[model samples]
Target: MFASNPSKRRQMILLVIITFNIISTWLHYTDNALFLSQYPGPEWFTSVGVISAVVVMTPVGLLGYWFYSKGIFWLAYLLLGLYSITSVSSPGHYFFPMVTPISWKMHSLIWLDGIMGVLLIGFLLWSSVVLKEWRSTSVGN
Candidate 1:
């Protein structure tokens, strides 16, 4: 169960959403790495390179959550926003040519990743608005 307090509830919801976004991103990157042939972007885009990005990005998302849990909203927002940027870019792959025909599996993951990124951004915006209202009321008191 989540707390009834708006701030706590918002934080809890954001945390769950953030975690799901992270997982969705990982799945997308893994799919890209494992099936690089479907992705016809560049010669440099090797499976190793793709997975290495996953290695680097995961920690950033985790750190964002850590900072969020520590009440550091700005840093958390920055880190989380940065982390979500990749997922937001996942759909961009459609703009490029594919070596082989793209399958529904890849398409679904790409959309899911992008949607998760959007959800994270929406939750962050909601959290900010809630925080602003909470601050204003406390300051008035």
Candidate 2:
């Protein structure tokens, strides 16, 4: 439904971001133990937690994608951009199961989120510029 190559590229970028967020949320639950603690959990609670995380996170991710696509992007950008900035402030491990003790996974997550925020801002500005040019070019015709 996009009219130009830039529009198509924007849509594709958005789709990729949406998909990445969804998958990240899923993987965050890890090892089917709901965050996959460095230690084991109680039997009933562990089962319940995993089931609950899957049930909740799938729809939650989809809903977030829907909101980002249909709602005011500035709102999402404001909240998520703030979050991205805050997340990178502390890069080391914080009592969680990271791939490495140095916390590269955590750092990568923050960096990826920050990059996404930057991309969103860029896309919004690019869209406005494209629209303005189109309007200016078409006005006399």
Candidate 3:
């Protein structure tokens, strides 16, 4: 169905990547909770809160893709950007403290989430530019 529209194709790819990023976040958080890391957040930022964050953010990314598929570009852009923020912020874990060494699994999860976020942000910016050009040229025709 999306073969005809390049934007749709790009959005689909982004959706998949972001989904993985979300999963990485979930895994990292679950690991963190299990190991009892000093997560830099509120006192309530326990396992439940970690779960809640993923639960809340997952819908935002999905809804963004849904909106994009329906051609609601403005809202889709907003939600997708918000979703990207969640992933990009994963590196904030490094800024606080380094009391004890983290396992390789946790390190991998954290970097994976952050790297995916960077990819998502890059794609979003490129997509916006393509969209603007596509619109202008279409309007001219």
Clash counts per candidate, in order, are 0, 0, 0
TM-score leaderboard ranking: 1, 3, 2
Identify the leading candidate in terms of lDDT. 1
Give per-residue lDDT, candidate 3, residue 84: 85
lDDT of each: 0.79, 0.44, 0.72
Cα lDDT tens digits, model 3, 1-141, are 978866557667877877787787778767767765544444445777776777898899888777766666667778988988877887877776765777777778778888888887777777677555224333111
Given candidate 3, what's the lDDT at residue 109?
Answer: 78
Give candidate 3's TM-score.
0.80
Question: Candidate 2, residues 5-97: lDDT per residue as tens digits?
Answer: 543455566667656654443443343343444323343437467557556645544453444454444453444434332222222224334
For model 3, the superposed segments whose C-alpha errors exceed 4 Å read 1-4, 38-44, 133-141
lDDT of 3 at 28: 72
The runs of at least 3 residues in candidate 1 whose Cα sits more than 4 Å from the true structure, single-residue gaps closed, are: 129-141
Model 3, residue 94: distance off in Å is 0.8
Per lDDT, what order, best first? 1, 3, 2
Steric clash pairs (candidate 3): none
